[model samples]
Target: MGVNISKGFLLVLVGLFAYLSLLLVLPFSQYVLGAILIAYVLYPLQQRLEERVAPPIAAFALVGLAVAGFVVPLVVIVAAIASDARRLLEQVNTDSIQLGELERAIEEQTGQTVDLPSALADAAQNVGTMVLESSTEWFSAITHTLIGLGLAIFLLYYLLKDGSDLLTWMRELTPLPDDVQDDFYQELDEVMWAVLAGHVMIAIIQGTLAGLGLLATGVPNAAFWTAIMIILSLIPLIGSFMVWGPAVIYLFLIEEPLLAVALFVYSMIVVGLSDDYLRPILVDRYAELNPAVIILGVLGGVYAFGVMGLFYGPVVLGALIAVLDVMNDHYDRLADEPGMR
Candidate 1:
């Protein structure tokens, strides 16, 4: 009893230290997890390269190539998009682009005056105040984001080279039987690729399609909204509709009925159907889960894990379900044992 008590006390102290250690890493946990996901996907390529080149050299080369090829281009695109969005916002704030035309058209149809310009002025003022209040917060956020990106890239290099050893350690540490642990890891791999690559590619495709449609239909700042739509498309069922839906309504209000009609049809048939047809193909069997799981996972993930939470949430939930199934199997085995009865 005394030994048991001592052991319990030791465990409690260890747990306390462990939790504190986790808190230290929490600020950058998203990057660590993101690195894991990217490294896993790139591991195959890394392995292929390792056969000819040295392992460390191959991993370093892969990371460098990815940063040069993928990350650099992405940053450039994002900066360009941000500049376009800023220009649009400036136009809106300065009244260079007036909603008054749309407002007058609405009032004409409904026979009720809507003073949208005044409201926009008020909105702009409120936004200005909000920006002033949040500037420091935004600075901190930007700093953290840059740090996270750097950490992710650095970690990816090592994970690509040494992840197999890590996997071995994880298996040994896991409490479950070897087979159950293997199964869980397999599921994790499959679901992760499905969630990340499947969702990201689909979102980019749909967002680009939506953006092109918007540009073709004469929507201002199509690039700005396109970036937003790509992020929103990570959500199941919502996809590009969030942008295109508002766009159609805006087009109608501006008295471009033909443009509105075209936008609506294109959104429904092209953007909407693309997700329906392609998601299952991309996600394979992982896409067959209840809709609520996806919604909750995504919402919870964003709240918990920032952007990467989008993939992390659904995958975590899937893992929990896998654990539950394993426990249920253990219970079933116990029930089958006559000695326990």
Candidate 2:
């Protein structure tokens, strides 16, 4: 009885500490967690390299390559997109002729005189003023982001270098029985594999199909839109729709009804089919999550944690389910044993 009480007290203390840490160290925790995730994704490659070379050297080389491979393309793509978006916004602001047709259409639809030219001028002025006022804030944000990136890289290096030792330490620290620890590790591995594989495959498929559709329909910024689709596809439900819906509406607004119809059909066939039909099959086969649970987990996670929440949210839910599953199995076995009842 005393031992049980002690264990309960320890559990409560641990929980309280965890809650406090989360509240106090959210920003630092985010960077560390992001680094850990990056390490998790790259660990397999690191392991393979270790088999071929010295472990230390292999880890260093693999982490370096992984960082470059992941970060460089991302930086380039984001910079390009930002440059293009700025240019687009600037062009839209400056080009007075572009608004003439839009104003006429609005006037025709509403049967009211719409002075769009004045509105556009006023908007441009407001944008300029806002940009000037916010320049310092933008620079500060960029500096913060750079600092976060550096911290993430440092965490990732240590994770790759000492991850095994850290796991061993965690195993020792966990209050659960040895059998439960093994089960927990196995379940966590399965969940990570399922999430990483399923989301990546779906993202690639959706991105490719969307890009192809846009290319076929002569949409501007096809690559940029496709990249956006890929990122958004990591979120469950309303994934492809967020990308294609606006494109369709824009095409229709631009008086390209036939092109809009083609885009809509193509998107339905490719994006809709893959998301509705293929994604569930792949995710279920690997993750073993209930469809309803996944939907709720994803939605709840997004609401709570934003983009990273999509990955971490489902992971937490799946981990809890795994723990419960192990407990249920153990209890059933105990019940079935002779004289236990």
Candidate 3:
């Protein structure tokens, strides 16, 4: 008994050390999980291609396609924006573009002196403080972001190439009944598809459409505002309005009443309705998670994991609910047992 107690104590000690060791690399955990998700999403295409070609080649092709289809356009857009950014930065002192025209227009309409600069003095000071504070950290952030992206892609390639084997190995390590393991994974598969394909994809579509509408309607700084909308769209009930709401008001303030009305109508009809009608069909049809659960999860996930929390939050919450439902079914079956009674 003493020997057994000593062994158990050693095991606990080793487990504690292992947990502490994982904390050291906790920063990379998000990158690793992101890679896993990317691989899972693209696995179907890889499987189809693998039938005709090798798995490695199939993964390579898919990765290339992903880079070209998504990353390439983003890189092009950034490159185009960079030149404009450089010119803008160079002329920042001379231009005073932030509210120069808007302020002048407001002053003209009201026939009142608008000390917009003075009003924004606090904001400018905050910005200055932020720049001063983060000036040193920006390089570190950029480096981590770049490294995270590269690692995600690299890990994605391997996951896609050996996913089946990895799943098999994991199953072997699991102590649960084989059928129980299967059920868990099957439910996980459905939940992941619903979260990634239905909710997340639809949100992106809504954001893109909204951005196009903004651009077509001639909203200034459309790209910048569109990015904000995409991030806001992650919240189930509250979406893109946080960005475009101000834009609509700006148009009215600037005497572009017609443009303001058009933007407001577009936002109400297109951006507004898409989140309400489309997201549920995608999520509820499979995930069975109500908007309330999702909203709570989004709020909690953001609080816990930050930005990636958008995807992580919904997926984790949906998976939990799915697992619980499966457990209920298993319990229902067990209720028939005389011993259970």
lDDT of 3 by residue, 220-239 (tens): 65666677778777777677
**How accurate locally, in lDDT, is each candidate?**
0.81, 0.77, 0.79
- Give all TM-scores, in the order shown: 0.76, 0.75, 0.78
User: Candidate 1 vs candidate 3: which has greater lDDT?
Assistant: 1
Query: Which portions of model 3 show Cα errors greater than 4 Å?
Result: 1-21, 79-136, 280-285, 331-341
In candidate 2, the residue pairs with backbone N, CA or C atoms under 3 Å apart (3 or more residues apart, or in different chains) clash, namely none
What are the per-model numbers of colliding residue pairs?
0, 0, 0
Instruction: Judge candidate 1 against the unseen true structure and give its global Cα lDDT, from 0 to 1.
Output: 0.81
Candidate structures ordered by lDDT, highest first: 1, 3, 2
Best by TM-score: 3
Clashing pairs in 3: none
* lDDT by residue (tens digit), candidate 2, 215-330: 78877777688888887776666576788888999899999999999999999987788777765677776656554565676778777766666677777788888878887867
* TM-score winner, 1 or 2: 1
Please, what are the lDDT tens digits per residue for candidate 1 over residues 1-341?
99999999999999999999999889898888888877877898998998899889999988887778777757866886787778777667555556778888989899998888788899999999999999999999999989988998989988988977888888777655666566666766666666665666788888989988998998877777888899888787777788899999999999999999999999889887887788777767553445577678888999988888888887788677766766675656645653331
Q: Which stretches of candidate 1 lie over 4 Å from their true place?
A: 1-6, 82-142, 285-287, 330-341
Better of 2 and 3 by TM-score: 3
